[model samples]
Target: MIDEQDEFDEFSEAGEAEMDENKGLYEHVNITVDPKQEPLRIDKFLQNFRQNSSRNKISQTCRAGNVVVNGQIVKQNYRVKPGDQISLLLAHPPRLNVIVPQDIPVNIVYEDDDLVVVDKEPGMVVHPGFGNWDKTLVNALAFHFEKNGSKSDLDRVGLVHRIDKDTSGLLVIAKNEYALSFLAKQFFERKTRRLYWAFVWGNMKEDEGTITGHIGRHPKNRMQMHTYTDGSQGKHAVTHYKVLERFKYMTWVECKLETGRTHQIRAHFKHIGHTLFNDERYEGHTPLRGVNLPKYKQFIKNVFDILPRHALHAHTLGFIHPTTKQDLYFESSMPHDMADAVKKWRNYLEN
Candidate 1:
């Protein structure tokens, strides 16, 4: 049986609904309609083909051009014929293996009987999936529990939310099932507060504004998320931003999400033509809104060297404690690389 880990082609379709989804790697599955197969709508065919898939998901995949029949992109209603070849591409490869515990160090912010909060560093994936089975935060959590004389099966468990592998920030892990359920309910109901800080390109006309759009995986660009203004294509998302500081060409902003769809902040800001600084996936490295002088270009390159990844950080998270029922808030200082990059920009303004 073809599973989530099956390697797929670059005709990318859709990604995880969550923003913290990993890379653009997709799983391709080929389905050959039997010679005796009856003519059926492509959407219906795919639903029968993958029982685990939903009808709405197939419809979105078709719109994204992930469904190909005999080498042609077809709409959801296109009829499938006998002896036809169909190729499918989907994103966010599912969990392929169990998470293995490692002795990796984790900076725990708080820990108790029900949950633990950690200040996750950059480049550390939140959980296990294809290509990353160990050294994840969950792996470290497993060791944390074991070292404390407790062993728990954390495979796909205890996580209430996730941050991108390259986006450093804070995350809360449920140590017990009750905590997971309670915390998850808060997140799903939009009761938790999350604040992300980003240094992006372009100056804003307004000091603060709200960005409302639907977020989904890019149809053609496999590595980036896309924002849909029409709301017919993706999940509804809202991001509120306030300018924290403004440089000659770039702006540092704080974002709060009403709906945490995949790449909500990145995609929403990109929709307004203000991509994040150093966000390679979204063309932040390119000169989108600045002068093209050689000296200015070289300065941007120097900034990129100091901060190699996207300038985004999960700085604050607030939610009611699952056990104590008390309101709790946690904050993390910006990482050194991003802080250093900000400092360089500041000094450039002076010099």
Candidate 2:
């Protein structure tokens, strides 16, 4: 029987071997589909495992005999059966430029030997990517850890979960491999607690409710995500939201995520006809604009100008400490812009 230490050693060796092979990214995961796992297309199944693999790339691999099911090449639409053996021969993705550590400042809300909880500011990308290749929270953490002789590699050092780039609030970073693995398991098992605050368009009729749907990439637009009803390709996502305050047109809401999908809160709210304020993609045009009241229209325009991104903040985070096994909770107040929006709306209502 393979013990935990042995398993870790094996993983380490495999990673080293892949590095030797000049593959920038490689992972071999073996999982048995649970009985609850609904039937999914083969390409979709493979896409879930490879985070950076595009759907087109997945399909091309399927056609090129890189994907095998039960030791035989299969089409993309092949239904994934439980207990079936699946193997993928994926080429390594192009290497990203080496990310140099930077001295970007971060708000450390709580810290211990095992982990650090940070109140990340809005407009700060968590990690390096695209146009945001430097001056990120990861770069700051790397610099800080280096000072203590605890630096980690590029793929992941302390990060376990991620909040959207524009979302402000509390986030946790693991200090070691044990903590990283434990926290990752918590996320996979849906055991962690995440809550958000958002100012959404329109007054909600219900005080509290849940939004359930399957989320996947937009069929035509590769950049955006959309709800899938045909079960063709998507993961089940759920969000529970309650109206905290209501104004003439907008509403302040507190949302809890039952399933954490990319853009889950933003997408789910939009799915329910209440796109978040300043959400350019989901809520394209401002309803309050062109109204007779010039003051209200100007207020709406100001809100948009001040906040250029989605009006969402990850206000609360609760999870078990990876190494200590102690329950940890962290919360952050809404950032200046969101607080200002709420204040102005309240003042408008009074007047």
Candidate 3:
């Protein structure tokens, strides 16, 4: 649930890495003047694309030499012409909390000058947020950097994408500005590939299918996402899924994200009547499928105890290297708890 947030809050999350144009801040934007673009003031041109951005903020950034056009810092009134490469590095909003280094253990898969790849375990929040102040993945990354004497101003330690606290999986962390910008672009453009493995409550009839809906904050419940099937509201989101295996009343599936909307896979599946197994937030813990006998109910409870959290895992992540331009792929096996629950279901089927 990395991208699950209010629409306005999304801008607060940093995506840009270090670029020659921007002073290496979290707020960065890159735009190329179109061939048919008429000569317009730089600030006005940016305002057209950035509706929430204010002219005063744009002016301040231009004056601070954070607006680069054709490799040169330009004033707010500079005329943007066709074929111009424009980059903006806006100031980061005020920090709410001071990030302190904590000696938390993390499973680092790969590390280099530009970035670090990690295989995150279940129950570890990726970054500090409301009710999650310490012992997060960012705290561990901070400690790792402090121990190595690597000083940086990057916020959230350059996390490009994140999984939910209960979801276990792989993540890529940028160590430098260039890598962050490069990876963020790939994610924003939907070029990176992410695969998740999940066990849902009901047996899916289709071998494979795509779920299309607009995902946004629930009107009544602010914590959850509401899927708009009519394309009337919310941002566009798509999830593609294929059935991998089936139990008596549950199914295992592989999910590929076409768009990284918050709670997209969970919400989209629920829209089609297949809530993820053990997903307490979406009422997946209820006996939505299977027999109504007391023994069957007890078995479901036992399985829930075995897998307390939702039965979902970020199985694999693939992206193009920021520096090398080569394809990079990472995979993590299912966590023990989820695998054990699957085994339990298999045993029940045999019996």
Candidate 4:
């Protein structure tokens, strides 16, 4: 059954009206630098005012003529004078609802007037696609907007980016058109921070390293992806990983994405011979059998029975708020099954 947080009735219909007026709009903040302040950079000063706004956004605004220092547009690093009259024009974000909303239950972590951060569970598809038509996150968001009488247009509602159906983690959902556009831009420009935790087979030789490759659809298997060398139709993907812990036959790793790509972490690990544990497609039973150790064999069998899905979870996400421009970060612990597997594996090693 779908669970929901208590309704926040503090907002009346009038409040919604007020929010509409402010949505996708920016307010100006003028600050006078103190001489003792040592002349902070323009971008830094603006960031102080817009707490959640990304540095890239501030830079973009300044470069686009939206920000004027002493009535003149300047580069992001321009030092602010003590009495500089900094004027900033905030633009409303474009509408983001391209798909129809369904009543999907999203585990909302944080919410405000402009956006929402949801902890999406595994097996929940973000958007509608082939083989799955309904009960998606978009559908649930549509129901939410409808219930509030904020029937957003199909082309512009709440979605910013998406996580794969089997990958669970924090996802940002925009509440209005302007916030949606702003957040989308941040993700597109790779200004947001996303960290994931996963259990993979084998110990990594290095503590941390970056994987760079061009990823594209598999030539033989249309449903799968492969690292492309010719770079004909693929985009550049980069994944950075740090070894967090190690087991006799497995390693717990933390991964950060410099560029978001389809199956990025999974594919990259597979490329490096450290495919995620219980990943059916990449690291199958052959690798497990290769160990030829009875205890290890029993552990693999037990793990497979209990953990049927990929051993990956989005552990942390951080980004600048689109409206208030404040820095925000959220984290989720590994699920019970993953934790259990780790514990059991470690105990086996100790014994």
Candidate 5:
């Protein structure tokens, strides 16, 4: 999850259709410079925003006219200005998905003839798409199915819903058409329960609250999401949250998603000005709270190093069984990175 990682990696999965083909080159990133953004060179700006991207690669792309600002090509040294519309095109076209099977391991918590429940680890892509084509959860499932010699009513497996690449948590996959239709309906009808744990910036104005908005792709940046509350854009989404704990500089909360949208929790928290901690795409990585004294600044840096990705996890999932008609719920323990960070925060607070 790089620059657009929250909503960037957060796509409206759950069977959202792929965008039209680029024919040859693909538009990988588009951005709308925030109104308050300070002047910076375009190359440096991109290098900072896109994780793991090298300056030489960015410079080379700029030299090849792959970087565009407001529909005009710009050089690496071109200073980015406020409200600038920037788009980056990858030189190569997207490879078609044959969905090659891989032997990647997945944590299958529950499995039946109808469905499988998996506790997906962080950094695993759910399906084959975009930069990830193979070595996905889907690929692993295919291998598992083939090895077990299981037959399904549907032509292929189905992912009931989707989580971001870097978001660790529970996911249900349909093994047959009946399971697919039944489980998919629950998600669409808002009958399923999806709960997330997130560490966000700032103390809340209240103990708990609901967030409502329409979420859609950012106009200037296709990888990120923007919320419109006037019912003017995207699909309606709702999230209910309650405070579980509070740190000196951050708040710990449990979020129940009433409706699933791409990056629903992350975008909603951002809309309310409590962006997820260490979320690079949403400006949460800049030490947004507390004085940057040597001791405190070092503390922030240590935690960031502990948990490199955004501080969000799909902690719990509940839904009625499609085949048995039994209600089922599963909760995952907090990942080590997050748990360790919380421990450090607790010690810091006590000291």
Candidate 6:
């Protein structure tokens, strides 16, 4: 049996190896049906072909449109025919290792018997997943919980929601089962208030706008999410954005998510042709808007270098307390890199 770590390392290599299908980020798996083979479900065939794969996992891959037959995505139950050339994008492996407590510091905004509020910094992943097993927020929480003398298990320590690895922000972790259940309910019902600040390309005609689309993992690139406008595919998602500041070419905007789908803000803005600045995964690393003069291009490239990651910050989060039943709100100041980039743009505008 392949260990989880080995599987993740292979998946990581595959992701960094090549990119195709309009710059998608996923590994390509190709196979051909045997001439003497009988009809079988695509998912079943994949299960047999991919070692250590469960039928449920293969079904999920098919549903996500990662399984294609003869260059077309096939349904989970699609019957494979002889001579069919099968090609698909394989999804990355998940983290399956046991969570071990690490003595890492966490910026705790507030902590009570029921919960703890944390200010997560950039470049720190929220949980352990493939490629990242330690130095996570969860690992830090485990240490904190141990110090507090709580006997909660590793998996149920207190994680109700999560922000992206590169997106810095405020997050709440439940300390007990009751608190976790209560907080989870609020998030599921969209009762919690979350706000993010992002610098995106292009100028908006309106000061504020709402983006509604279906969001799902990109069929060709599992690394990113794709927005579906027709509502025919993916989960329903909504993001309302308001312009906070307008630069000569870029716009700083505030985003409020109505549905917390993965990459809702980034993918939704990209759908409207306003990808976030320095968001390399979605092609925001280059200048999408603005003049193409050598000086201007150089300036943009310099800004990208200064701000190494996407210009997105989860600045505000608010929710009612589960035990105390009191309303709570938390906010985080913008990171220094983003602040410095904004300052550079301001200087350029002055000159």
Name the best candidate (by lDDT).
1
* Residue-wise C-alpha lDDT for candidate 6, range 34-148, written one tens digit per residue: 8887999888888988866556556655764556688787898899998888875543322336778899878998988878889987788777755676788888888888888
Off by over 4 Å in 6: 1-97, 148-152, 289-294
Error of model 3, residue 29, in angstroms: 5.2
Worst 10 residues of 3 by lDDT: 15-24
Clashes of 5: 1
Local accuracy of candidate 2 as per-residue lDDT tens digits, 243-291: 8989868888999877766577777777778888887756534754434
What is the lDDT for 234 in model 2? 68
> Where does the lowest 10-residue lDDT sum fall in candidate 2?
1-10
lDDT of 3 at 92: 36
Work out the TM-score per prediction: 0.73, 0.71, 0.77, 0.69, 0.71, 0.71
lDDT of 6: 0.74
lDDT of 5: 0.74
lDDT of 5 by residue, 143-255 (tens): 88778876742224366677777788888887765565456546644678778899998878789999999888878877567889998888788889999999857999999
What TM-score would you give candidate 6 relative to the actual structure? 0.71
Q: What is the TM-score (0 to 1) of candidate 5?
A: 0.71
Q: lDDT values of the candidates?
A: 0.75, 0.68, 0.74, 0.67, 0.74, 0.74
Off by over 4 Å in 4: 1-105, 147-155, 229-233, 285-287
- Flag clash pairs in model 2: none
Tens digits of per-residue lDDT for model 4 on 1-351? Answer: 111221111111211111111223233445555655668788888788677776666766665455667767777789887667666654333234356556667787887777778887777766544545557766676677667775454343455566667677887877655565566556655678889998888878998899888766667864456677557756677889999998857889999888766677777888778888877756543344467555777677887766677888889888888767799999988877788888888777787
Span of 10 residues, lowest total lDDT, candidate 5 = 17-26
Cα lDDT tens digits, model 3, 191-303, are 78789999998879999999999987678876567789988877798899999999858999999987777677788888899999988877898876547544788888899
Tell how far residue 99 is off in model 5, in angstroms: 3.1
- Predicted candidate 6: what Cα RMSD to the true structure? 12.1
